[model samples]
Target: MPMTVRSNCTGTLPSVIAGSAYTCSRCAEPHDGPPLGYGTPAPAYWNVEAADQPGSVLGEEQCVIAGSYFFVRARLVIPISDLDAEFDWGVWVSVSEASFERMSALWDKPERVEEPTYFGWLSTALPLYEPTTLNLKTKLHTQPIGDRPLVELEPTDHPLAVEQRTGITSARVQWIAEQILHTNPPMG
Candidate 1:
């Protein structure tokens, strides 16, 4: 499945504000602003075979492959130093069956945030990061009823983790947008 990049702003590039006349390096067109979020439609482990298997399930917020491998879509938030809004990666994490069941049971409840953080492994392979952004240690933090769970990486020297901790600049966000847009064609 193709990854989806979503921008709350109306522009085509990442800029300080919407409708900014920033010329894109890739397309040379004036872009509005950067996308606030990017997401993979399924976990990295998911494939055509997995999708065809019995008992496999894939939904907007959750995934189960062969009734064994469990995944939940969560937000990996990185604060932007120069912007008021933060950047987010809509990534998936692998969790144990027990954790998946507990999360499902409380999926619609307002008190689900009271549950302790669940240990998980990052299952999305993000581009533009060296040493692959796969299998990093993470904690799935349940949010309010309407929000996706937050993915907190285990403190490490990984670039993604470091960015999450210390934040990134608007320039970095723009570079990210450029790389992603240039590489992945817009979906129909």
Candidate 2:
């Protein structure tokens, strides 16, 4: 199912406001406001066959597949040049068992924010990028108790990495929304 891009902005605006509404090129639905973020429900490795596999666990913030594969949900934030708010991708990253255990142990503790960043591999593939997003190197920075970890891409020449480092324009954000909205199977 496609994720609904809800309006994060407050108050109402007149439809006449230029660029206030975005018409999805694929669905033809007019989104009233810019989307602040999108997220995946589960890691790409958690396929239908893995759904009921034993020794596998999938949770809102963490996941384990076959007691070998470890994953954590994280936020990949991109600054929008023209807006105060950011564009975020709620993605998953594959971590080592040791890192996963440490994160799990500190999951409910506020002090977890003090922990060092964990090395991880991008486990979710984002849409609209030329090169596949999967397997990208990342550093997962733990946040407060209630916040998701932040996934920082390694400094590289990838378009996503460049966007994260230099920021993207509002027009780029709109283009992203359109592409993701129309993508088959939908993007998080």
- Worst lDDT run of 10 residues, candidate 1, spans 7-16
**Runs in model 1 lying further than 4 Å from the true structure:** 7-17
By TM-score, how accurate is candidate 2? 0.86
Task: Report the Cα lDDT for candidate 1.
Answer: 0.85
Q: Cα miss at 134, model 2 (Å)?
A: 0.3
- Model 1's C-alpha root-mean-square deviation from the true structure amounts to 3.2
lDDT of the candidates, in the order given: 0.85, 0.78
TM-score of each: 0.91, 0.86
lDDT of 2 at 178: 73
Number of clashing pairs per prediction, in order: 5, 0
Tens-digit lDDT string for candidate 2 (71-116): 9988898887886557777788999999999999998998999999
